[model samples]
Target chain A: MARLSRLVLERLMRYYRFLTETAAKEAVETITSGEIAEALEIDPTQVRKDFAAVGLIGMGRVGFDVCEACRAIRVTLGFNRSYEAVLVGTGHLGGALLAYPNFVRYGMRIVAAFDNDKQKIGQTVAGQIVKPMRMLKPFIKRRKIRLAILTTPAHVSQMLADRLVAAGVKAIWNFTPTGLAVPPDVLVRNEHISIGLAEIAYHLKDQAAC
Target chain B: MARLSRLVLERLMRYYRFLTETAAKEAVETITSGEIAEALEIDPTQVRKDFAAVGLIGMGRVGFDVCEACRAIRVTLGFNRSYEAVLVGTGHLGGALLAYPNFVRYGMRIVAAFDNDKQKIGQTVAGQIVKPMRMLKPFIKRRKIRLAILTTPAHVSQMLADRLVAAGVKAIWNFTPTGLAVPPDVLVRNEHISIGLAEIAYHLKDQAAC
Candidate 1:
């Protein structure tokens, strides 16, 4: 089967959100790629292709059952279950990411946070108390958390990722300056601030020139 | 010409980053869709199709000039430049995101930060001091800064965005729950957090099910 594109995954998520919001008010048995495109300002062909990647077939005129499509996307994206995860580096960036209200809502939990800071070691942020870095392996084993978020300084991202992987993490959302080098089986998503800023800078420059 | 796909733009940004880093150290000439796919583990056809969207032509085996392709992608992404922006919500999140090393490296600058609180208003972060919210418009106008990074609270986002728009903000990277409705001409990219968390939760569920 063809892999679902990130663009498709993103739209599927958006469509799922809209459908849920719509479901609260009314029964939606069918949906159309056109409607999704019009609402999201995305291309209909892209939407169709995304759905097709998931092996879903929308009805010709009747469209897709809104709930069904949402379910399918969720299942494909591994969203239909709950995931317990740990966080390393409970500093500002980590705190902000943990404060993001969507984690638990999406079935991902930050059950514990690890830090070497003496002051922060026992304190709680976003309902997760910080644990000493030494306790990482045991914590992961006990909690059965497979995902980790790294908000450590750039110099330590690789080390932090290694720590998490050693503790049995399969995926990591890295917010450090240094990107990690991990095995192919592990998923690493680098949320680089420089890249985002650079893109924005380029846009602002163009806008100014225009 | 067909518009460039977002995925291509994203990859282009990554490629640009790499080239900017290696351009001085190495003299490279060409790139192939297959090479890019191999490096990123993405589909080769996907690379070709994305490039075609922007009218970037690569020969069968000869591929494309690395520098030229880099330039083409940068132009396509409007990346031959930089942008100056402001920071709001001088709390932990605001401070850390501002202190992020990625911004300047990528091409964006946060020239100033504004806060309503007296304690934080005069403090410095990322070498830029926090200014009172009252000075926002003047600072923005003087710098001709159009993009704003908003880390304000949900209850305040609307009013804050309004003030920013009134001060001539053309784009916003919102880091709050409140979705500010703006004029179509003014671009608003909501880093809609709750939505992000919800998506995570949904993914967790799917993974757990698996």
Candidate 2:
């Protein structure tokens, strides 16, 4: 399969969510592209294209099998395999992520959390005992953990990220405001909280202008 | 100013963050589009266009004034004026949001938090005492609140959103996986955590394919 664009990947996640929800709620065995498009407000042709890109096909008039569609998406997006992730910065945001119930559903798990603060070290947060920063490198090496979630302050995030990369972390889910400098092979997904605030602020300003 | 596209708005926020950070860290009076673009890995021409869209102009040699650029982004993104927002559902995510340090810097204040849980009603989570669900309508009406951050469970999100819309909310920052059905006048920004997971999983799989 060709590389999926970021927009298409996002839409596929939405479709996966919709299909799983529909399958759980209703006894429907099949659904058409039109139904999925309507539920997601996506163009029907685009839905068909996305489905086809993921190697999904529908019958002549019976539409696509719901179970088959879900399986295809799961395999395409690599959600069928579980990923173990270690989270740094046991702050409120980190705690929230640790407690988040949907990560398991998405096949990602936060197996451990780390903090530099002596007070937070050894404390249990959302069922995961917080470890000191000293243990991060050894833990990642022992577990061969490739994914690291960075929620530390902006100033220290870069240093921590360098350590994670040097310790064999290939992917970093950055929740800090500062941009990270990582190698070409490493994937750093920056989840900027302020982007949402900016969008809301802009929309409110636009509405007030009208 | 003409309406900015979503991509442009997001880029503007990045510029704003970079400018503010530079102003604090250095004594630089001006910054070039190339400099901003390099720091963000955005195209220089696109950075210039974004600056122009926000009414910022750079000198031929000296470049744009750092403080002026920050002010322009703040005003263009509606960060100059403060917005009062109410939060629904005081979950761990909600607590993380309440503790987030950047919202105030971006001109948003979570004036209150509401939850239907009996135990959480009177308890304070991150300075704001959690209020009962019954207080949501009256408080919003009394304060004329127009923004709401929803962190409720998926099952109750739509019903809560309906109540929020009736209570005079114009924008909703939804953190649930469930799609919300709001009035045409209300804007819902769905922050799907699963989207990030999907992206990470796909990239990991893509790398393995190679």
Candidate 3:
């Protein structure tokens, strides 16, 4: 298989989501690349390239098998297997992610949650008891948890990230906007919410101009 | 000015953020596009093109004035002025976004929050009292709110979106996974959290393969 660019992979995932949702709605079996492109508002050529990169082929104009395409995407993105993870910071953002049902569907499960707030510590959130931040190291080490979902405040994000990495975390899904300086050996994904908002704001600009 | 691609504009926003954060940290007043490219991991040529598209130029060697570049980006993205927006769900995600202080920094303010939950309707989240869903229409009309931040459940998303649009919302910042079918005139931005996680999972696969 060819090495897919991050943009292509991201679009493929979006296509997969569209396909899966369509399939769930009724009896959708196959869908054309053009239809996916139109739904995603992306060019057809780019969708075709992404399909080829993922080893998914459409039958001329008949389209692709929905199940097969989804399977291929799941396999390619490593979402076919579940990974146990931990969440730090039981604030609203952290609580929201913990309650989110789709993370399990995408193969990442939050098995534990931690917070430094005395009032919040020991409370149950999303069926998991919120533990004190001091217990993070022991819990992660004992369970061998490798993934950390970080929603800590920006002021303490880097410091907490260092602590997570030192406690045997290999991946950090950071929701905070703070830039973390994790080691090369550690994987970090920053989900800056402001960037998404800015995208909408830009489009809104176009709307206003018209 | 040339029409910028959505991807380019998004990258420019990221660069603007990097520049602003760096400026906040030090006495830095100027920066090379090359340094911005390195920090963002984007090609230098692409950054140059993006800069030119926004009518910002750098000296042969002295680089660009950080303040000037930021102003250009802010103006182009329409982030220079504040936008009054409302939240439609007071759940965890809604509450988190409502409490997000950075939204103000980005020129958006959540003026109010609405939820159908009887227990939450009169309560305050992020300093805004959660109103009943019944009050959404009147409040939007009375306040002349044009922007909506939707964090409602998937089942009721489309229905509520229709109501929001009918109430004169021009744009929606959707945090739900469900696809909305709003009129062409109404803009919708879906921030699906799963897609971000899948991207991280894909990179994790590469790490494992290595």
Candidate 4:
């Protein structure tokens, strides 16, 4: 398999999501690359390139089997296996993600959530008990947790990230606006909602012109 | 001014965010292009191009004034004016965004949120009252709302989007998995958190190989 660029991987995820949703409808057993492209507003060639990179072969005219394509993307993206992860900082954003019902469908489960707020500590959020920050290291070590969702504030985000890294977390899904400094060995995916909002703002600007 | 591409606008928003954060820290008055590039993990040339596109000028050695750069990006991206938008589907995701304290900082505000759930109608999520879906049309029309945040379930997303469009929404900040079908004049920005998560999953896959 070729090393996929971040852009390709991100698009592949969108494709996978579209496929999964289509499969759920159960109205179409097979869907063509063209159909997926049209639905996603992506170019057909780009869709084909992404599918080919993942070694998925769509039938020439009949299109790709919905079940097969979904499984292939799941396997390729490592969503076939469930991952045990912890959520740090059980604030509004953290709690919302914790309560997200689709996390399990994506083969990831936030088994625990931690917070430093005394009022929030010991409270169960979305079926997980909120533990003290001190438990993060011990919990990671005992459970062999590999993924950490960092929703800490910007001031302490890097500090918490460093601690998570030292505690042996391999990937940190950052929700803070601050950029995290992690070693090359550790992976970081920053989910900044404002970036998307800004895109909408610009698009709205264009619409206003029209 | 030349029309900005979606890619460039997104990056410019990022630059704006970085500048705002720098200004908030109060440590730096003027920051060099090199510093912005380092902090954002973007190329200095790319930063220069983005700044030029927005008609912003940085000092020779001191770099760009944080406040000035932020204002420039805001004005260029249409963030100079705070937009009045509505939030559809006051579920966990919708409610989280509604409760988000920094929407105004980004130059947008959720003036109202609509939900079909009888139990939720009239209750306040965030600062706005959770109005019934029946009020969506009249509320938007009366307020001349040009933007909407769609966080509705996949099943009703398109139906609701159609109504929103008919109600005069110019743009939709969609958080649903469903791909919206809007007229060319109406814009949609889909913020799928799973895309970011899948990228992290793939990167974790690659790291495990090592």
Which structure among the candidates has the greatest DockQ?
Answer: 2
Tens digits of per-residue lDDT, candidate 1, B1-210, equal: 454434555666666665555465577677778877776566888877766765678877788677777676666666556667898888767977777766654556788899999988788876878899899999888888899999987779989899899888888888775557788767676665444443344334444545
TM, every model: 0.71, 0.98, 0.87, 0.95
Docking band of candidate 3: medium
lDDT of 3 by residue, B1-210 (tens): 666776877888888888898889886989988898888778988888888888898888888899999999989888977778989999888988888888876778889899999999899898998999999999999988878999988889989999999999999988887778899988888887777777777767777687
In order, the TM-score of chain B in each prediction is: 0.86, 0.97, 0.93, 0.93
Error of 2 at B84 (Å): 0.2
DockQ of 3: 0.58
Give the CA lDDT, 0 to 100, for residue A23 in model 4: 82
lDDT of each: 0.72, 0.91, 0.85, 0.86
Q: List model 4 lDDT by residue over A49-75, tens digit each.
A: 888888889898798888888888888
DockQ scores for all predicted structures: 0.28, 0.75, 0.58, 0.70
Top of the candidates by TM-score: 2
The parts of candidate 2 lying over 4 Å away from their true place are none
Share of reference contacts found in each model: 0.34, 0.67, 0.66, 0.72
For candidate 2, give the lDDT.
Answer: 0.91
Candidate 3: clashing pairs of residues: none
